[model samples]
Target: MVIGAGPVGENVVDRVRAGGLTAAIVESELIGGECSYWACMPSKALLRPAIARSDARKVAGLRESVYGPLDAMEVFAHRDKVVGHWKDGGQVDWLDSIDVRVFRGHGRLHGPRKVEVTSPEGERHVLTARHAVAVCTGTRALLPELPGLPAAHPWTSREATSSDRVPERLVVVGGGVVGVEMATAYQALGAKVTLLVRGGGLLPRMEPFLGEHVAAALTARGADVRTDTAVSAVVRDGGTGPVTVLLEGGDHVEGDEVLFATGRKPRTEDIGLETVGLAPGSWLDVDDSLRVTGSDWLYAVGDVNHRALMTHQGKYQARIAGAAIAARAQGGDSALDTGRWGAHAATADHAAVTQVVFSDPEAAAVGLTLAEAERAGYRVRAVDLDMRSVAGAGLYAQGYRGHARMVVDLDREVVLGAAFVGPGIGELLHSATVAVTGEVPIARLWHAVPAYPTLSEAWLRLLEAYRG
Candidate 1:
């Protein structure tokens, strides 16, 4: 049985059925989960037009023609179409074809191996799992506790992504992926955007240069990128007027809409974790196979496990967990391969996790940063390349300002991590992911020649810089 039919849960059930096991999935909301409706799909849809226009503006002859603001309505319409107008019929049909039982309700742990589901009509049903129960309830946007925030009707990630109309003025409070991406989208769609980052830099989790490039680009696009700014309170008169965000000092910024993209908390608050001797609202600890710690039958996949919050990472975990459960059900512990990089192990969660921020001058990275690699006690060398020097990048854009950094493990002679910050660099991330995940040696990478006159040639440049 799977609780919360998000992408993670759906993947779990799909894999379980593929493993020749009967499965049931329970969800209170849509079948495809957050990625299908609110978070990834809609957010990316909103970003693509903005990014495309921005890229076009950088081209030589095309720059003059694409300078106008995006058609906000058309962009919203396209976004709506991408999300199937917030419908899940197709997703439901796919599940039906898979022969997976779907329970439309709020599913909670009744006890060991048992789930109690309450439907929207308040009808109750209990299900007992034959092998395992996977909890894939993803997270919701976390709004900080501040004065008048709730009363002011602040927008979380869901509202930010799914809103039909763009606000005239948007005050985004966070430096994370959601904050930067939305700021980029709204600014391009003809909104005055003020991005408030409590931290000193954006994309703080990645290399420092990535955030630096993104900040410069956002500022160049006329966004008010404020760093080290802390919000003390927020107020909106009559709950329908402009939101006034009070800063730590005697200062404030007003906007037609305020978005809090500070962070995310697990959605396990009311999923009956207390019944299973776990905290009611906490991230579930899991082993390499995604099974909840100290329990054989309980597996926590996706954001609920706090392994890697990205949808793709969650789906990866689901695949591993589903396979592990099947193996255990078939032939006990002997049937499972629990070693690192094994068929049932999610080792990549620790070693080769990848992320791409859809902000202007896209930031993509995999594995460790230079700081992260050094902190991990590896003997590392940081090789840097100005992406503008690459022939392909120069042809791709007029200025083509960007940077690439590859952290090499000197002892092992393998790529430890890599980050690229520039326009259209999102596609260049997978090669880095492959290098880090495969632990491909620096010598071997030198032989893996990159195609000339492409942004990918940045790899060859990085290798040459490392050789120097």
Candidate 2:
């Protein structure tokens, strides 16, 4: 049994059936999870075209000349197409093809191997899993305490993704991925955007150079990006349009929409976890097999587990949990070691998970930032470079002030982390992820060729700087 038809849960069910096992899936909302609907898919779908347009303007200087105006309606229609009109009929068909049972409403554990599902029409069904129940219930937004916020209606990522109307002005609170992505989305949608970031800079988890580069890019794009700023109040004065958010330090920001792109919380409050001896924060604690800490037949994955929160990471976790469940059902060793790829092996969550903020002049980092590298007790050597030397970047972007950096382990002669910030660096992130995860040695990495004049050349340059 799989709870929450999110990317992780859906992947688990598919893989379970693929391994010739019977599977049942329960979903309270959409299939394909938040990424498929709200978070990754819709957000990126909105951002990608804008980015392509931005790049076109940068290279050919043809902003108004070549592309006169974009139809947001048409654009949204295309996005809806990519999302299959926000319908899970295709997903349901695929699941049925694989022989997985589909149920609506919420699902939770009743006991060791039992799951109780509540349907939308108040129908209840109990299911007994012969192998295990993988919990992938995902998560909910975490709203901060702000005066007047409740009374004045605010849009979370959910509202932002689903809304057909683009507001005149959008004030985004929180400078993380959601905040930045939504900020770019609204800005591209013709909304005057003021991004309020509580931290000193956007994507503080990334390298400072990347953050600085992205800050400049967003500023250049007319986003009123402000870091070291916190939201204080939300006021909805009639005729004043919609929510007006008061930021810290006496500055006032009013917007037709206020998006709380703040963070998220595990959906632990209402799940049936407590019924099975779990505590208040009943996001099931799991073992190497992803099996609940003390129970071998109960496994957990996705946001509910409080692991890595990205959709990609969640899918990987699902694959691991599914494989473990399959092994257990087939009388294979169930001592699932996450590092060994059997027990919800999102090993990258701890070892190295690359994060990319897809706004213009994107920010990216894999493994650890310099600060984290040092704190983790690595004797780290760092190098920074302007990405202009890369042939592809120079040709693609004029007046580009791109930057790249590498955090190296002095003892191991290997890169501990890397960051690239520029117009097209988002695509450059995976190479770093490969280097970090593959533990490719620096000398050998130098021999590994990057296509000439390409943004990939930055990899070679980073290696050169590291040696110096």
Candidate 3:
């Protein structure tokens, strides 16, 4: 039995059936999960229109104007269209075609080989699993405990994505991916956006310069990006009107709506996990093999297991878990370790890997930041360069201020990490990712050659700047 039919769960179930095994899918929410229906699907729907309209605003066909605003209704409609109107009839048919049984309700583990599901109509069935039971129950949003904040009208990612109306003024309480993306989208849709960040800078997870570019681009787009600002409390300006936010600095800002994009925590609560006689956070842990610790009959995958939170990463984790379970069921020695699979392994968790912030200008990064590298006791060489010298920059935009960095293992003569920030540098990350993952020697990486007149030429330029 597969618990949670999110993308990861669905992928696992499909894989199980393809192995000629009988599998049942249990879901209590939308089948496609956040990516297909809410998080990625709708957010991208909102952004694509702006990106296309912006492109059309350039020296291109029809050069249409008066396209003026992003119609939220249209965006929502498009999202629904992509999700097939949120009707699972199509999904249900496909699941049936795959010969997998579907159980609609909240499912919980009863024992080592037992799954108990409560149907929507109050019907209950005890399913005795003949094969392995996989838990793909994904993560849930983490809400910060700010004083008097819950009383105010606050929009989670869900409320914001499904919004049919745009607020006149918006206060986004976090500077993470969701906050910046929503802020940009709504700012384009004509909202006065004020983003408050508790961190020292935005995208603190990436390089400082990358964070600077994102903050600059957001400010360029008319968003008031405030770093080092925290919300003390949220006061309902009562009587069904706009909300007012009081910052820790004794200042106040009012907006038609407030959004909380703080972060996310795994969804391990109230699922009857304790009945398994396993401790929380430890037993539900997915090993490199994607197996639940101490139990071969049970496994957990995706964000709920806290493996990797990104939808894409969760799906990959689920795929590994699914394959492992299938192999074991077929009586194969499927005992696998997470140490191998460079870039594919859980190695990145211990050693930081490439990550890019997908804000307007975008920021790409791989491996440790300068501070982190130094702290980890690496004899390091770090250099930063203006992105314009690289051919990739000139092609990105006539007026583009980009940044690039190269972190060298000075002793090993290899590149430890690299980062690029500015328009279109997001794709340029793959080259850096390859370099870091392959542990490519700096001298050899020079010969890895980026095409002429491309942003990637920045790689070679960065190498030169390293020596200077």
> Best TM-score goes to which candidate?
1
Candidate 1 residue spans exceeding 4 A from truth: none
Stretches of candidate 3 above 4 Å error? Answer: 18-20, 52-68, 237-239, 279-283, 331-338, 342-345, 348-354, 411-415
| Cα lDDT of model 1 by residue, 1-468, tens digit | 999998999999999999999999999999999999989999999999999988898898899999887898998999999999988999999999999999998999999999999999999988999899999998988889898898999998999999989899999999999999999989989899999999689989999999999999999979999999999999998899789999998899999999999999999999989988999889999999999999999999999888788999999999999999999999988899988789999998998899999998999999999998888999999999999889999888888899999999999999989999999999999999999988998999999988888999999999999898
**Over all chains combined, what TM-score does candidate 3 have?**
0.89
Candidate 2 deviant stretches above 4 angstroms: 61-64, 237-240, 281-283, 332-344
lDDT, residue 19, model 1: 92
How do these models rank on lDDT, best leading?
1, 2, 3
lDDT of 3 by residue, 1-468 (tens): 888888888888887776668899888887777777778777877766765554344423345663577786787688678767666777778888898899999988888878899988989998988878888877666788887677785898888877877789999988878887888778877789999999688777767887788889789778898999988888885535788889987998889899999988766675667778865433267676577778868878777777556776667676666767776787654344445663224555445355656566767787777888898999998978898787656655666678899888889977777888876677888788778767788889878788888888888888888766
Between 1 and 2, whose TM-score is larger?
Answer: 1
User: Which of the two, 1 or 3, has more lDDT?
Assistant: 1
lDDT assessment of candidate 3: 0.77
The lowest-lDDT stretch of 10 consecutive residues in candidate 2 is: 335-344
TM-scores for all candidates? Answer: 0.99, 0.94, 0.89
